[model samples]
Target: MHEDIHVGGGLVTAFVAYALAAFVILIILRFAFARLRFSRYVANAPLAEAGLYVCVLALLIAFI
Candidate 1:
């Protein structure tokens, strides 16, 4: 029996790609939230931001 595994640009490259993607997503979310005054309604803005970042990162990893 034989098995094949494919590695994408090795681990370090994958990490950097995901990190850059998350950063870009967070920045865009920050601007959109600020422009729409979405943070005013949240009792904990920092926590909300963190949650949003995680969610966005998860979505990106899952879809892309």
Candidate 2:
């Protein structure tokens, strides 16, 4: 008999953790840029932040 199981649990969890960390780092970068008045040079910062948030949510879902 054969059983179906997933062996990538650790990988999935790691992906989730990495995504969360990336999200946090990106947020911090965005905040620092805004505070330093460099946001104008990087207008896509908000978009990148939003994309990272979405990626984090997706990774969490994937891990589950």
Candidate 3:
């Protein structure tokens, strides 16, 4: 009988940690920009919001 080896846990953990950090940073930036009146400009620009969403998603996917 043989035991199978589990691999890639460290890489997965790092990806999860990175994703959490990125989420936190995004939340912080969202609030900060709102407080600074930047969100108003952002709201008026649908393209910007779409672009941001795409970029964040790509980053998350890449980390995974």
Candidate 4:
């Protein structure tokens, strides 16, 4: 539960880890969404994508 993690002789916020994990998940989601035509389900596709990132980040922080 540290606020920072050391990597390659430097300290970075723990949030960065969560953010990166979320980004990877988002990348996978992107492919799935492409196949599903996700844009058609949302009026603002970009906003929905951003919201998905936030949700994924929160879940990672809460569970991992």
Candidate 5:
């Protein structure tokens, strides 16, 4: 007979950790972009931010 293993809080913990990491990364990127006057060059700042967030999330998932 095979024993079933239970992972208590493991999934939730990993999710929260990834979310926190992404938030921190986005904040750092925001400051860097602000310092470089990056918004001035972008036609749609909100859209760009969303795209950046998705890209960053994908990268985190791919590499992590």
Candidate 6:
């Protein structure tokens, strides 16, 4: 079994850790996307970003 994340408050569950990691990655991805002018190419920028977030979240959960 996987270990829980130790935090100042307490231990966070594995799924929560995966979600937090994914969110951090999404933040970095947002900056890169903005620098690349990604929104200009997408028909629905927010929706695309949301999809990216879900993909990142899923990958994190599956791999780690």
Q: Estimated TM-score per prediction?
A: 0.72, 0.44, 0.45, 0.90, 0.72, 0.81
lDDT of each: 0.76, 0.62, 0.59, 0.94, 0.75, 0.90
Candidate 3: which pairs clash?
A: none
**Candidate 6 Cα errors over 4 Å, as ranges:** 6-11
lDDT of 1 by residue, 1-64 (tens): 1132346754344545665789898999899999999878999999999898888877777776
Candidate 3 positional error at 49, Å: 5.5
Q: What is the lDDT of residue 14 in candidate 2?
A: 52
Tens-digit lDDT string for candidate 6 (1-64)? 3688788979978888777889999999999999999999999999999999999999887786
Q: Is candidate 3 or candidate 5 better by TM-score?
A: 5
Per-candidate Cα RMSD to the true structure, in Å, reads 5.7, 8.6, 8.1, 1.2, 6.0, 1.9
Per-residue lDDT of 1-64 in model 5, one digit per residue for the tens? 1233346843344545555678789889999999999899999998898888878877776777
For candidate 3, write residues 1-64 as lDDT tens digits.
1233345653243545555666676677667767787756765655664566557756766754
Model 5 misplaced regions, further than 4 Å: 1-13
Superior by lDDT: candidate 1 or candidate 2: 1
Candidate 1: C-alpha RMSD to true structure equals: 5.7
Give the TM-score (vs. native) of candidate 4: 0.90
Model 4: clashing residue pairs?
Answer: none
**Ranking of models by lDDT:** 4, 6, 1, 5, 2, 3
Per-residue error for 16 in candidate 5, Å, reads 4.1
Off by over 4 Å in 2: 1-12, 48-64
Residue pairs that clash (backbone atoms under 3 angstroms), model 5: none
Poorest 10 consecutive residues by lDDT, candidate 3: 1-10
Q: Judged by lDDT against the true structure, how good is candidate 5?
A: 0.75
Clashing pairs in 6: none
Q: How high is the lDDT of residue 44 in model 4?
A: 97
Give the winner by TM-score: 2 or 5. 5
Total backbone collisions, model 3: 0
Let me know the TM-score candidate 5 reaches against the reference structure: 0.72
